[model samples]
Target chain A: MERERICFTLNNSPVEIHCHPGERLVDVLREQLDLTGTKEGCGQGECGACTVLLDGRAVNSCLVLIGQVAERSVLTIEGLAAGGKLDPLQTAFVTEGAVQCGYCTPGMIISAKALLMEKQNPTEAEIKEAIAGNLCRCTGYIKIIKAVQTAASARLEG
Target chain B: MQDQVVGSSPVKVDAKDKATGATKYPGDLRVPGMLYGKLLYSPSAHAKIIGIGLADAWQVPGVRAVLTANDVPGHNGHGVIIPHQPVMARDLVRSVNDVLVAVAAETMAAAEEALRKVKIELVELPAVFDATAAMAEGAPLVHPEGNILSHHKIRRGDMAEGWARAAAVVENTYRTQMVDHAFLQTEAALAEIDDGGILVLHVATQYPHWDRKELSRALGMPEDMIRVVGGSVGGAFGGREDMSLQVQAALLAMHTGRPVKIVCTREESFHAHSKRHAMVMHYRTGATGEGRLTAVEATIIGDTGAYASWGTNVLRKAAVHATGPYIVPNVKVDAYAVYTNNPFAGAMRGFGAAQPAVAYEGQMDEVARVLGLHPFAVRWQNAMTEGCITATGQVLESGVGLRATMEKAGSLVGWDVSKING
Candidate 1:
C-alpha cells in the first residue's frame, strides 16, 4: 500500500506525517506522533480509553480513521498540564484518591474537562453523567465523583 | 500528616502516562516490516474438520504466513486451569469460536481478505446450550470426559433439624446476567522471533508472568523462549488473564520472520473474551419468629460455558459464601459448574460474592416481611461481626466490617428509613 501525507495539530503543535491509508488515528498518534497518552481500551468506541479532544469534543481516537483527522486539532491528556504543573482536575483526582488502576483516569479527565468546558458549575449528577461512559472498574465512582466536585469548587472559589 | 501514602491515597503511578496518551498499549505497537494478522473462526458450534483449504489464501497478494493446528510446536492446548482448549482447533471444533487458521499480511485489509479466501469443510454435530440440559442423560458431550465440569458442596449442620427448629422460613430464587469486562481496550499483541531465536511478545494482560508460562506451554516453546511484557492495559477486570492473540501472533511472527500485530475488533473482543458466569441460585432460609437466624440452604447452578476458566473456583466460593454474612449455625450449600455452547465464563469483579449479595439481601428482606420485623432490625439481629465463622468453616480473623458497614448505612439512612423494606 502507498503512504499518504497526513497533517494534524496534536496537543498544541502542528505535525505532518506520512502513513498507510489504513492506519488508525490512535496508532498514528502513538507511533508516529509519539503521543502515547491516549490509551486504547477497546478498538471499538465502547471504552473511552483512547478518548481525546477532537476539535474540542471528547471522541475516541481509536474509532476515528487517521484520514478522518487530517488537518484537525487533537488534544490528549498530555496537553492538560501547563509548565510542569498538574491540571486542577488531575490534582483533585490525585488528592482525592480518585484514580485506581489509572487506566480510566486519562479518559475520565478528558471527559470531565469536556463537561466543565460546557458547564462552569455542573451539579454532582452532571459530573456522573459525563464520566459514566468512561468506566473505572476499581474505584466504583465514589471518589471520582468527589474529585470532580472538589475541582468544581476549587474553580469556583478561585 | 506525617508523609503518609498507602491508605492516604497517592495518584495512580500510571495515571499521568495513561492520561497524557504516553502509555504504549499493546495496540499502539508498530514494528518495521511488521504484518497484520487475523484469525479464521469456525462457523459451526460443534464440528469435525474434514478438510482445510489455505491455497487460495496463500496466493493472495501481501500474505506472508498462514498457520493451522499443525503449526503449534508445544502442548497444542491452553486453559488457565485445565488444558481443554486448543490454541488452534485440531480434529474437532468444540465451540463456535474455535480458531481454524491464522493469516498474517502486510496490511489488516489484506490479512482480513486473505482470511476470507480460506475455506474450511466441517461436519456439524449436535450442541448443548444449557447446563442442566447438558447434564441429563443422552446430552451432547461437549468434552470427551463429560458435560459436567465440577461440583462443590458445603455442609455445616443438619438442614432438616434447623428448619424444624425455626418459626419463620423464606425460600426464593435469584439470577444474575452475563456481564463482560467491557474494558475500553480490546485484545491486541505484537510479537516476533528475535534475531537470537527467542520470541518477544508484547501484550496487555492482568497476569503477565502467568501468560509467560501459559503461552510457552501452548506454543510448544521453552518458557525462556517467550518473554511477555505487560502493556498499558486500558482495563482488565480479570478478562485478560486468559490467552487471546499472543500465541497466534507469536507463531505467525516466528514462521514469517517479521513482526506480527493482531488486534481484535470490538465484536471480536466480545466474542473471544470470557464473561461473568450467568448464575441461578435457590435459597431456603429459616429464622426465629423474632427475626433471629436459624439455618440456611442454597443450591447454585453456574453456566461455565465451553472451557473451564475459573468456573470451578467461582462455584466453590459462591457455595461457601452463599449464606453471606449472616450468622447461621446450620447451613448446607451445593454449587455446580456445567458446560454449555455459550461464551466462556470466568472471574469478574465481586468474584462470586456479587451473586449472593442480591439474592441473600432479597431473602433477608423477605424474612423480615414474614416475621413483621423491620429489615434492618432483622439483619442487625443476625449480621456477622468480627470472629464470626463463615459457612465454609473459615473464621474471619480480621477485616470483618459487615456489622460496621450495616451500622453506618443505617445511621446515614436514619432509624425510620431502616425499618422500611424495599
Candidate 2:
C-alpha cells in the first residue's frame, strides 16, 4: 500500500496530507488533519454521523475514500461557525433543545445547513427528508425538526 | 417543590463540547506508543475447543502479543450477578460471540490480520435455541446447573376459588423478540499503565466504579491498581452497563507495557454486548360480569441466553409486575430465566417489565371485550386505589393514580365519541 500526497481545502484552509488511498475520508480528516468533529457512527454509510460538505453537497465521509476527495473543498461541523459566533443552526439547536446526547448533533446540523443553503425556507417534509439519513436515538426527531424550522424561520426574518 | 431549574429547560453542560466535537469519546483517544487490540470470537455457536494454534499469529509482522484464556492472571469469569461467563473461552465455546484470542499490534489492520492467522479447532455440540426446549427433559445443557438460570414465583390467594367465582375467562400467550440497545456509539476502551504503575482504563460505560472492581478481580490486581474513568458516553441505553472490552484492553496494555485501544465495529457490538431478554408469557385472567378482576395467573419465561448477566433480577421484576397495576385478590405469577445458546441477555431500558406489561394489558383488553364493557372503564374499575394491597403483600398507602391516569387519557383521546370495539 502506497501513501499518496493529496491537497484539499479543509475548513476553508488549504492543506496537504499524505494518506492511503484505501483510507476513508473521515479517517483522514480525524487522524491526519485532527478535525475530530466529524464522527464515524457506523463505518457503513447507514449512519450519517460522518457527514461533511464536499463541493457544497452533503456526503458521508465514511463512505468517501481519501482519493475521492482529492482536490475538493470539505466543510465539517468545526467550520460552521466563524469569528467566535455560532451558526444560526447551532444557536437554534441550542435554544430548541435539539442537542440531546449530542452524538448526532453535528451531523444533524450539517445536514440542516446543506438544506438551508439550497432552500431558504424548506417545508417540514423537506426538512425531514433532508435529515432522514442522520439518526438521533435520544430525542425523537420532533425536537430536531423544530430546531431546523426555527433556524429556517430565523433566516427568513433576518 | 417545583424549583426554577427543576421543570425549566436548562442546557446540558456538555452540550456545547459534544456539538462542537470537542468532547472526546473513548474511540477518539490516542496515546503515544499505543497498540491497537482485536479479539477473535468463536465461530461455532456451541463446541468443545480441541486446540488452538497461535504460532503463525505470533510470527505476524508488527504483532506485539497474543493472549488466550491461559493468559488471564486471576479470575477468568465476569458477570453482574453470577460470575460464570469466561473472559476467554477456557475449554468449551458456548456461543458464537465467545472470545477465544486477543491480539495487540501496531495497527488495527495488523491486529486483525494477526487474528486471521490464529487457528482454533472446535468439536460441534448440539445447541439449544429455545428456552422451553432447553428446559425440557433431556435437552442440551447450556450450563452445568441446568437450563433454568433462576425461577421466581409469587402466590397470593387461591387461584381456583377466584376463577370459579368469575363469569368469563380470557387466556392468551404473548411473545417478544430480543432487542438490542442500538446506542449511537459502540463499545470502546483505551487502557494504559500510568506513571504511578496503575492501570487506567478510559471507557464508554454506564458504571466506572463497577468496571474498576470487575477489572481488578479479572486481572488479580489490587483495587487501587486499577482506575476506571468513564468518558462522555455517546449513548448507553443499559447496554454499556456490562463489561465488553474494558478488561481485555487493560490486560493487553499490561502485557505489552504500552497503551492499548479497542473499538467494536457495529456487527461486533451486536454480537458481543448484552441484549434485552426475549420473553414468552402465558396469561389467564378471570373477570366477573361487572368487569371487576377476580383472579390472574401469569407464567413468564425469559430466554437469558448463554450466560446469566442480570437474569435473576430481571425474572424477579417480571414476576412482581406480571399483574400490571390492577388489584387482583387471587394472583399466581411464575417467572423463569432460562438459558439458551442465543446472545447473552441483560439489562435494558425497561429491565424486564415491558414483556409482562404487554401480556397483562392485552389480557385486560380481552377481559373488557368479553364483559362488553369499555376498555378504559374496565381498567378503571380494577385499577389499584389507595389502601389497596398488591399481590406482593405491599399496601399502597399513597400514590395510587392508575385510575385517574386512565380517565385522563380517555378524555384526552375522546374515548366516549370514538368506537370502543375497534
Please identify model 1 stretches exceeding 4 Å from their true place: A1-8, A16-34, A40-44, A62-72, A78-86, A118-121, A139-142, A145-158, B1-7, B397-399, B416-422
| TM-score, one value per model | 0.90, 0.97
Q: Compared with the true structure, what per-residue lDDT tens digits does model 2 show for residues B118-189?
A: 989999999999998988999999998899999999999999999999999999999999998888888889
Query: How many backbone clashes does every candidate have?
Result: 15, 0
Residue pairs clashing, model 2: none
**Model 2, which residues run further than 4 Å from truth?**
B1-3, B417-422
Tens digit of per-residue lDDT, candidate 1, span B1-422: 44876666445676655445456778778878989999987787788899999999998899999899999988888778897777889899877557889999987889999989988989988888777788899999888889878989888878788998899998998888879887766789999878888889998888889888988887777889788888677678878878877789888988999999998877778767778888888999899898888888888888888889888888888887798888998998889988887778888887777887788889999998998988898888787887888887888888878777876888787765444434
Query: What are the per-model DockQ values?
Result: 0.50, 0.70
Q: Write the per-residue lDDT of candidate 1 for residues A72-147, one digit (tens) a residue.
A: 9988888888666777788788778776667778888999988888888899889988887787766549988898
Q: Against the true structure, whose lDDT is highest?
A: 2
- Model 1 TM-score (B-chain only): 0.95
